[model samples]
Target: MKIAIFGPSRRVGVVVDNDVVDINGAYAKYVADTTDTARSTAAAALEVPADLNSFIEQGAGALAGAKAALAHLSANSITTGLDGERLVFALDSVRLHAPIDGKSRVFAALANFADHMQAAADNTASGSDKATLSRLVSGGPKYFIKDPRVVSADGDDLQFPRRTDLLDYEAEVAVVLGKRGKDIAADDFGSYIYGYTLVNDWSIRDNVSFGPDFQYSKNFDGSATVGPWIVVDEGLDPQDIDVEARVNGEVRQSGNTKSMIHSFAALGEYLSRDSTLFPGDLISGGTPKGTAVDSSIRDSEGGFEDDSAFLNPGDVVEISSRAIGSVTNTVTGTRTGKK
Candidate 1:
């Protein structure tokens, strides 16, 4: 029951390859060819599962119904032209967009990992006063909200800002919210999730500090690199997966989700309380240890200063998770005022 949205930009069409069904096409075909009623969201096209947001709008029932329909199709050996074709397009061919576009708000955790915080501390000249994941909860849930414009899909190039020489990568697994819920109970957190994906939170080391507004550092354009795809049916516990960050095929970061201070369910429930969460909202649960920023593999001998080694043009970044798959992107730099 792995579903995907394909096409250019916001005009993506839905596809369920296993069933040879096109949710977008089926909706149109049914409205014109059958007696089925059109749905405001893509959920009504149960014969074909649509986007993750559609799952959010329809809830758990939509998933069950779509599976039943897909089962019926699989048994009959249904074949659509898009079956194997679209899947091939997904592999290194088409540029993947954020699985769900225009998500209202992105909830990001800060210092959610003791090792990550320690790495952050190591990178900067600051003393060890920096909090780690295990000790972060001594206060409240340390979190941040990312500007939606900063979000970009996989296979796209991120522009390295020339103003700052330090560009770092934080590998994390992000959850896609499936349903709208406020004050969600911990027991019912699973029902609110659609699936998971890998996130590479690109950062500007200099801009990030205890300033009046920390959002400026994390919310730059293309700072949010998500997708490759969302696993709609792969019943995975986000906190149980392993995450890795590699640069030019060299593993720079490696850690397991078991080290997360707050579990995925807890973060979701905490954010939803007293606040409304809509379909397509992204919740990134932070990264683990061995991040590139904390490693000593930079080309400091040459003019490539240690800070300049953060991320330069022509560098490739690969972020992967055991369950959500991998997403790789190339980095390119541009002078700020240059036309």
Candidate 2:
């Protein structure tokens, strides 16, 4: 089942078709109106948290509670007086926030896709060695930490950094962890994962050559675009899902998760080696071959003269996947001065 935080109150919601059911509100009312024994049982069965992060931390219990609550609302519709019509809200009536927020560490893998690595390598200056890309292919999955502050929800504007002119968008599948564990095995990744979400790993191409750290380019405010909603991992295979990105309305990036050199499970194992992988922590499984800055589309002078290839102020970027829904954001604001 898909879950989201929507409306003015940012209440927890369960997505049913085109409507969102207020799970938290409904469960609270259910507890308040029921008998003492019933209330206790309901409370135990549905330990629904106020936010998405806490709800995910509850793991299987949360899933079971949500199902039970939905079942309860369906079985005794007249008794509760909170039927589908009253509890469910149309998708357009509410606004979405970053599904996982508040202390969720965002880890992103780099050069995990062969095509992306090749494209990035080909885009570099002539005679430049692609040792890093080669290392990524041969060695274990390499990851970088992204500031959770950069996370923006669907329909929100992606704020352009004042320091750079070469902004780019990367389409990736973000894995959300359900449980905390250290030295987690790759095979046991399914048990640890709570769900999956779409992520636009925005980057500033100009910043890469000027600095050794990627934080300056990748971690700017509103760079990481995530959400629409989270699809729970109920026998879902994230490794073979279709991922794509579009600017305005034109398709730019198109690839599959199956092309990933390091699978999500492998990346999970690598990430959980020394540190604890907690619930709500996000791990983005890198993008495909088609970023705006790809050398394949560059001219002989090594410049992309085409304005449409790169993002400009007021441009809309939509990242979509079959397993997870689409995350659409517009470039509403940009700063021109040097930092």
Candidate 3:
């Protein structure tokens, strides 16, 4: 099901497929109303459950109950419609919001590709041991956090900031955690997952290496563009999917999840062991080889030039993975108005 959380900040209403029904608020009320008297953790918390988290937290039984109620409702054709065909939105109608808002921690892996390592090695063959090394060659998934404030929806406009002119797009497959787990094993890892989503790890590569840390280049106002939908299905493997990025109709980057140095299950089990992963936390599986930003084949600029189609105002960036849906976002005017 394609679940959507919409409406103004305070007046926001959770709807399923543009329905007027308040699945979001109803799910919350279910927990608040039934937590004390609810007999089964999975007992029906409300007429319909808004998200997987609510159902899981309420317990397996509550989730089953909610599903049953939804099924019954479907059988009877009793439901509310939120003007599915003609709904008006305050933001750009095409603009997308983070599928799940306020994702507390965004753990991203840097250069988790052997190709990236080779490219980085060639770029610094002088052996000048400067800081800021690519983690793909040195260690496990290099984790980073994306500020929640910067998260945007799949089709929303990515605002370029005034700080830098160098902007690059990373095509990646991101995993959406459905449940909390600690020290989870790779073999038993599927249970903790909710589903998959597409994430474009957009960044400013030039200033990224200049700063004392990557946070500056990586965490701009609108860097993390994620999601069109959250898929909930079984028997799906993350490591065997095709990941690609397209700019304005041309394919800029293309690779497979199989190239990832670390698999999704491995990273999940590894990250969860000491720290708990809650529902809605995003773990980006990392970009693949062929990133124009990191390539040895430099454009005429001597430095990585924007000609590799560094995003300009009105450019469309699309990230797609077979396992998850494709997310197409447009680059609007830079936050600095320099572009």
Best by lDDT: 2
Distance (Å) between predicted and true CA of 246, model 2? 0.8
* Candidate 1 structure quality by residue, lDDT tens digits, 1-339: 444445553323333432224444333333333345545234345433455465456655655655554454446554332223321233334444676666557788887887866664554443323333225545656788877656777788888876666678889988888777899987888888887777888876553454457777777888888776767767777768888999888888888878988877888888988999988888988888765555522232222224533666788999997676787889887534322
2 versus 3: better TM-score goes to: 2
For model 2, the run of ten residues with the poorest summed lDDT: 77-86
Which scores higher on TM-score, 1 or 2? 2
TM-score of each: 0.79, 0.88, 0.76
Total backbone clashes of candidate 3, pairs 3 or more residues apart or in separate chains: 11
Residue 286, candidate 3: C-alpha displacement in angstroms? 0.3
The digit string of per-residue lDDT tens for model 2 on 268-290 reads: 99999998888899999999988
For lDDT, candidate 1 versus 2, the one ahead is 2
Q: CA lDDT of each candidate?
A: 0.66, 0.78, 0.62
Number of the predicted model whose TM-score against the real structure is largest: 2
Please state every model's RMSD to the true fold in angstroms. Answer: 5.4, 3.5, 5.7
